[model samples]
Target: MKALVLSGGAGTRLRPITHTSAKQLVPVANKPVLFYGLESIAAAGITEVGMIVGETAEEIQEAVGDGSQFGLKVTYIPQEKPLGLAHAVLIAREYLGDDDFVMYLGDNFIVGGIADLVEEFRTNRPDAQILLTQVPDPRAFGVAELDPSGQVVGLEEKPQQPKSDLALVGVYLFTPAIHDAVRSIEPSWRGELEITHAIQHLIDASAEVRSTVIKGYWKDTGNVTDMLEVNRTVLETMERRIDGEVDEASETIGRVVIEKGVRITNSRIVGPVVIAAGSEVSDSYVGPFTSVAENCRIADSELEFSIVLRDSSIRGVGRIEASLIGRHVEVTPAPVVPSAHRFVLGDHSKVQIRS
Candidate 1:
């Protein structure tokens, strides 16, 4: 089986940061969100992979060259615009050929791997198998309505009034049968060929459309809050280590990993915190659930539950919590200002003063 990962999308929700980098490349625990999906595909023993890229194609290509580092061979498929999920599949028809492929969203993070689901799909050989999970706001996502027997009987994308609370997860498994479905459906009102519509077409045609309800942690990481949350979740499972220098004045606690070339002096770090290589923490308090990326410098500051990316500096910051500082940025305390009372006694007729 092969994998088709969608790495293209105009990440409007994650602006500012997405304005500078691809949303798929957002770091969770200092690792790109796209890498997590790629790793999961590799773990499932799927090596032949095709990546769908859009406007930020060059950036994605530079970061993920041939996919050789991840034990998979990657082929770049360019999309002029993000028409829709179904459009991605339509354009990738040549790369997918006649093989069954798993479609994954690069920016999505599913805690567990897809091995189990892949096994189920291979065993049943369903025309299409989709993962669903209960979401608080179903209207914002492509929702699925189930029948009395819990079968997916209806599908809607970003509806005003959702039919069910079960929303589609970012992972999908499909056989070559889906190729025909894509061509059969026309564009939706939004002028894009939504995958939900194509899947509905298959359902209408009596195709074997199966659904699996996932209970594990999953996130699209489309915004700052979700990015921070995913980072915290991944950090919770990290192992403890001290590979670099820690001065006698420095103190390390809990599950902390100091990568090689990291240097800590007179700082107190409480894990699960990760200090990447070439990072230096001096005279600071590095609190829990934080990741200091490579070449970053944190001096005379206090940080907790934050992610400081490569070459960034946070010195004399007083205190910072729950922030995503981008690469090569500098964060320091604002200048001090004096507060005093000035006297102005000039009114002659009816001047009133209270002290």
Candidate 2:
């Protein structure tokens, strides 16, 4: 089986950051969310991937570069626009051919990977198999309705009246029989051919469409809150390893990975934190669940439960928590003499002040 990974959506939810970089490329725990999906696919023994990309195709291509790093041969499939999940499959028909394939959303993170799910599909070879999870709010995701016997009966994309709390997860297994299903469906009111509709078509046609309600951790890192949450979740499993220079005045507790070339002086770093290479943290409190990327500098600040991207600097800022800082950005305290608040924020930026 092959893999079709969708990396083309315009992430309006993660505005300002997504405005500059691909949503899938956003880092969680200092690693791109897309990388996790690719790694999962590779681990599932899928060696060929057709990466569906959009406006940020060039950036994705540069980063993935033939996919040899992940033991996969990747073919870049350019999608002029992100029509829908089903539209992606429609265009990738040539690359997918007649082989059974998996469709994975690049920004979704699922703990424990999809190796078992792939094996289950291989054994049953259902027409389509979708992963579902109970969500507090099902209106924001595709909803699945099941029959009394636990069989999938109906599906809807972001329905106003959800039939169930089970939201479709980003990973899906499908056979070549899905080609006809996509061709048979019409675009929804959202002006896109949603994958949920395609799957429903299979159900209506009496084709075997199965689902597994997963109890594992799964998140769509589309917005800042979920991104930070996924970061914290991944960091919690990290092992403590300090390869950098920490002066006598500095102290570290818990699971912290200080990459090589990092220098920490007079700082207190809590556990589940990772300071990447060439970063300098001086007179700062690097709290838990924080990921400071390579070449960053943190001085005289307190940061916790946040992700600071590469080449960014946070100096003299009182505190930062539950945030996602973009790359090459600078965070500094305002002039005390001004006695006025000032901000140079980008479009769709959200900031909360401690009045």
Candidate 3:
């Protein structure tokens, strides 16, 4: 089976960060989210992969290269616009011709990987299979409704009134029969061909459709909050490895991975934290669940539960938490100004002032 990885969406939720960088390229624990998906595909023993890319195609191509690093031969299928999931399949028809494939969202993170799901799909050979997980807000995602026999009976995308809590996870398996289904469906109200609609079309035609409710961890790292959460989740499994230099004045706590060429002096770092190579942390408190990317400098500052991208510096700053700092940025103490309170009192106005 082959793989089709979608990396083409404009991540509006990620805001200013996605303005300059691809959302899929955002690092979780110093590794791009897209890399994790690629690794999972390779682990599933799929070698030929097609990546659907949009305006950020150049950046994605540069990062992934030929995909040999992940043991897959990648073909980049450019999408002028991110119309919808079904539109992606429609455009990649030539690349995915006649082959059963798994569609993975590049920015989505699933803890246990899709090896078991792929294996199950290969064995059962359903016309289409979707991974579902119970979400707190089903209205924000494509939802599924199953029959009494656990068969998928209907699907809807971001419905106003959801019928179930089962949100479609970002991984899907489909056979060649889906091409006809996609061709038969029209665009949704959102002006795009929704994948949920295509799957629903299959259901109406009596084609075999299946759904699996995954119990493991799964997240779509589209926004900053989810990105940080995914980073924290991935760091929880980190092994303690200190390849960098830690001075006698520094105290490093549990499950910290300090990469080579890093220097820590007179600082305290609490882990599940990862300090990448070429970074220096001096007289700083790098708290738990933080990832300081390569070539960053943290001096006389305190940071926790944050991600600092490459070449950024946080010097002489106060505590910062639950943040996503972009690359080559600087966070330092602001210049002090004379303190004063100036006010014009109106007639019959009562005022209290501290002297």
* Clash-forming residue pairs, model 3: none
Best by TM-score: 3
Rank all candidate structures by their TM-score, best first, as comma-separated numbers: 3, 2, 1
- Give the alpha carbon lDDT tens digit for every residue of 1-355 in model 1: 9999999998998887788889999788889999999999999989999999999999999999999999999999999999999999999999999999999999999998899999999999999999999999988899999999988898999999998899999999999999999999999999999999999999999998999999999998998788888989999999998999999999999999999999999999999999999999999999998988999999999999988888999989789998888888998888988865566666675555565
Residue range with the least summed lDDT across 10 consecutive positions in model 3: 346-355
TM-score of each: 0.95, 0.95, 0.98
Model 3, backbone clash pairs (residues 3+ apart or across chains), number: 0
RMSD of each: 2.6, 6.3, 0.9
Computed on alpha carbons, the lDDT of every model, listed in order, comes to 0.93, 0.96, 0.96
Error of 1 at 205 (Å): 0.7
Candidate 1 runs further than 4 Å off: 340-355
lDDT of model 3 at position 76: 100
Instruction: Write down the lDDT that model 3 would get.
Output: 0.96
Q: What is the lDDT of residue 207 in candidate 1?
A: 94
Report clashes for each candidate as comma-separated counts.
0, 0, 0
